[model samples]
Target: MSQLDPYGNQTPNRAPDSWVPDPWLDQPDREPAGEWPTRNGRADEPYTGSGDLPYSEAEAQTAAYPQVQPRAEADAEPATDPVRPRRPGPGKRRATGRAGRNLPAAIGVGVTLGAVVIASLFVWRPAFLAVIVVALGVAIWEMSRAVRAVGAHPPAVPLAAGGLVTIGMAWYAGEDALMLGFLVTLLATLVWRLADGLSGFGRDAAAATLIAVYVPFLGGFAALLAEPDDGARRVIVTLAAVVLSDTGGYVAGVFFGKRPMAPTISPKKSWEGLAGSLVATAVGSAILLYLLLDVEPWWGAVFGLALSIASVLGDLAESMLKRDLGIKDMSNLLPGHGGLMDRLDSILFALPTAYLLLAVFT
Candidate 1:
């Protein structure tokens, strides 16, 4: 019940609120209208009591607000409240395991491919050669597309044609013809790049030659394996050994692979997985060779060990290539498996190794 200050707040010696009526409501007289007061007779400058304010520059800046820091209790909520569950990753539901692949699709595709290989291989020799041709063609096409990213325009047509000739020579003609055909293909690839002009001739020719060697040259050994009367069995044993190695590695990598083998190249690969591959390959090779080729079981072990090491190297080499090319997969043609090249990576290395081993053992 006191009179107020200018802002309508009660002061120590003020009269009661009832005694002091509102000035704006009670007063009748008004001052004559005039221009508003300004600092230094300039409207831009706001008035300060003493001349120009010393902190005018600082005052011109917007007021800094203190950031609202998060509460410690909120961060500690997850630890204390056992009922609140953490969110899972996006792929956790669909992925089969830590590898993050659709396991069902991968297995189905693998079985189908294996069945096709066996059917063609045993049914007719020409049919198996046709299969090889088709696989190499697709691989070359994929590489052609992949290399374009690096400005290397490998001629896919000549590459495919040369691959056909190479595989045909290896299967029908003999080992000498195989060498002759490879040299011819290499020369053909060099000449093929000439049509594209000399802009990137060296680069393009190099890539094309690499494709020729990697795809068909290595694949010719498979044809070599199938040349003998008992050739089909030899090829089968080689395929089984490589497949077992991959399977054993995959299983072991999933369960016991804590230490990475080549983390920079393939993060999923581990030393423990490699151990599994060697054991599986060796054991499987021994059984298959003894049963099919009438060879000693120990020879099979030697063959398996060699093929396993080569297969791992092949896998790592392709991984390095893909990493260099800045691609995850050569193509998405094969769901769950990635590309034909991906499937053939280990096979390419294993084929030559198997051929060499069989030549020595048998």
Candidate 2:
């Protein structure tokens, strides 16, 4: 057998003809056991001889084992690792698919129910109007709540007094009496504002008073629709025209709306919808007049056109009020809809116009 030299070279003293060099030790530049080159070139190899270097028994054991790479370094190897999955954010969970469908369904149901109730009031006049009166009062309270929410301090005394007076005059008095009551309420609002030392008193008072009259006072005409003779028919026909107009506008707007009708006031409205509303109202009113009132188709067309235009203005007026107050809806009293004020907003102008027309022509 051949003996190996310190550098693993074959020695001639022992069986040099039969010597077999170890493959690992045969490489001259390769590091030996317990030996590694120093990074700073201070030491070429680790000293394993007795007392040749300061090292503990554990360090000696570690030196005998192979060094392992850190987990971070191992993980960075692209072939051995899979990509991490991304986590979802908070907003991702709040996405809803039913909002669009649900909103329209809610509005449709609410309007149908409201129309049914209004029609019933025509059958049971006293009881129905009483309910409407109570509803109006509640609506006023809701408006007051909304006003306060936007940081406006309204005079409660004048608001309540004006609301009651308006309701009373509407119930018992004629048109002149109703107008006089409105004037009195306006004066009361001003006085109350002055007593409270509130700034923007004029504007606030005017707004509050108008809200009462616009919501309930105009609603009083629904009661007058039940008068004997053809009065009820005329009122019902007018209401039918308004309803048809609204339905036409909503359907057309959804399908063919292109140009905005009133972008600043109502962003969703379209000229297409407005035109549809006018045509539908005119046609519907003509049919009602021919069938119910024995009136000429031309007269019906004129009334319908006028009422449809008025309804658009009514809608815009309410939009302006809501925009000024920084509110989207008046109240959430009605499911999927808003408060009585919201439902009655379009009817407000329509009712008064119908009443005036009837007073003059009928």
Candidate 3:
């Protein structure tokens, strides 16, 4: 016998025990007809076995309805749509912290720099001055470019020329000449920016003056340190103490840093790392001062403590400046170290501090 289905198509009626399997039913991947909308706009109810159906109720349900998934399996499925964005896997994201840097390259560059500095200090003091001049020039150039990125047009020519004069005067002439060089530089900067019209003259002149003071003016103290007898030892002690602070901070920060020092400006710095720097710098400076300069251990500790704090301040200050300027590094001139300014920042801040303390105590 043949009967009409809900869709008005003919459906065969056979003995329940002798019915053959439908082709659609054999393919479990396809949705069953009962799930489709009917003429009344409702999904057809589960097939419990209609009056004219040839199959038993269990067979009807099994062949015409989807099976209920287990509770665990259903819960295990993803809640979000497959098309939505997901968190990047490890391979997709940047590696951070110590693991992210090229440690070997950084170490190599550091060692090479240290060797050059030590040799310059020992060979001839004036040679060291030349090195400082070259470094300050690069640092000034970097600072000029960085400030210019933010619409400030610091005159690099005057800044560099004045820096050479300032540093050379501090070395050969004295403190008075250093002051004169700085004043002249500031004047030149003001005059140079005036040539560009008064549009941003003050802003441009201010930036150039800051570069002069921040880089060459402070750096002149290094030349002063080299002027005294046993000057090389003093310079070495200062450089060594700062290096020890940085090294200790890096090591401790990588292993044990928990709380951020300044999350907004410098996310990587930590109070614990600062403590490490202080302790290491204090001990290292004390030993160097006592053995080399014949200074009392206590005074050396004081000097070290002061320099460590100054270095920290310098680091944070540069971090704030970079954040304001929207830059990661001043430049990528140095493969692992970022730029001359990045490496010089701490040293520049520490230089005057070291010089004054040594003069007072020794």
Candidate 4:
């Protein structure tokens, strides 16, 4: 049956399966989408998308019409609209943690570093001392950069040289030599700062002093651990406690962290994580002390608890420093760890705790 279109033209008779022009895609001046040829070779009426019809109603009319299959386009790959990267639809989005932190790589590097350090400790005292010197150099370098953020420029050369001397003396000469090295580093830093002509001399000198004490003086305590008969065992216990504390905190925080331990300085740190760290370190320290060093389990337990606290303190201290300086990680040297200083932050405090424990126990 012939029917009248909106334009009042008689529509041609056609088969039920014959395709019609889609009005939805048609333009005012151009033909409608997909017009078919009539039986006598004239084109069927083009659907005009114009008119006062509602957009939804026009879409409904288009749906009622079927599109004709063209031979050329048929052989072509289905024209898939480009898969654009999707912006998430409106609603609350998923929460994301610290991005790009490669935990597995960090763990692997930590294990490898620990193995190397333990090996060096037993292989030769000088080798271990060298290792300490190298580590101190890296840490001091990182700190030197950190202080600059606050407009303080410490003397790097004097500080690094003094750090090496401090680490060496702690192992070879004793605590007294280590102290002397620290004092000399301070004097040298002050003298070096004087050359810059008093603009920020006080700030620079003070920062240098901090660098001297923080990197080498405090770190020198690790060398003293080697002074005892089973120094390597003591070193191992110290490291194990700190490492266990960190690992426990991370694992627990991931699974069960609720309350933030420090909201401003380190937002991710949680009380639950700290508790996990303490418990794990306590147990681990006791085992290492009793089995490895053959020390009394009670003493091991005390050392564990103490070192765990020390480790947390060290981590917090570093976080505070970073927050003050407005920096995230110390550097990008280590993939998961951030930088050398990041890894050393907790151990710096743990070293002194180990030395104290050794002094008391021995």
Question: Candidate 1 — worst ten consecutive residues by lDDT sum?
Answer: 42-51
Error of 1 at 325 (Å): 0.2
* 10 residues in a row with least lDDT, candidate 2: 93-102
Worst 10 residues of 4 by lDDT: 91-100
Model 3 clashing residue pairs (backbone): none
lDDT of each residue in 1-362, candidate 4, tens digit only? 67665566877784546646557544446545355434344445443445554445555688899877798887789868898887887764443335347757776888889988988988876678778888889999999998899999998988898788878887888889989988988898789779879898888888998888789999999889877778888888889999899888888888999999999988889999999998899888888899988888888888889998999999999999999999989998887778899999999999988898868875
Q: Candidate 1 at residue 126, lDDT?
A: 76
Candidate 3 lDDT tens digits, 71-115: 998879668756877899876664344636556667778899888
| Each model's lDDT | 0.85, 0.71, 0.85, 0.84
Whole-model lDDT, model 2: 0.71
Question: Roughly what TM-score does model 4 have, to 2 decimal places?
Answer: 0.74
For candidate 1, what is the TM-score? 0.75
**Colliding residue pairs in candidate 2:** none
Output candidate 3 Cα RMSD: 12.5
lDDT of 4: 0.84
Residue 118 in candidate 4, Cα distance off native in Å: 1.4
Candidate closer to the true structure by TM-score (higher is better), 2 or 3: 3
- Model 1 alpha-carbon miss at residue 168, Å: 0.9
What TM-scores do the predictions have? 0.75, 0.70, 0.74, 0.74
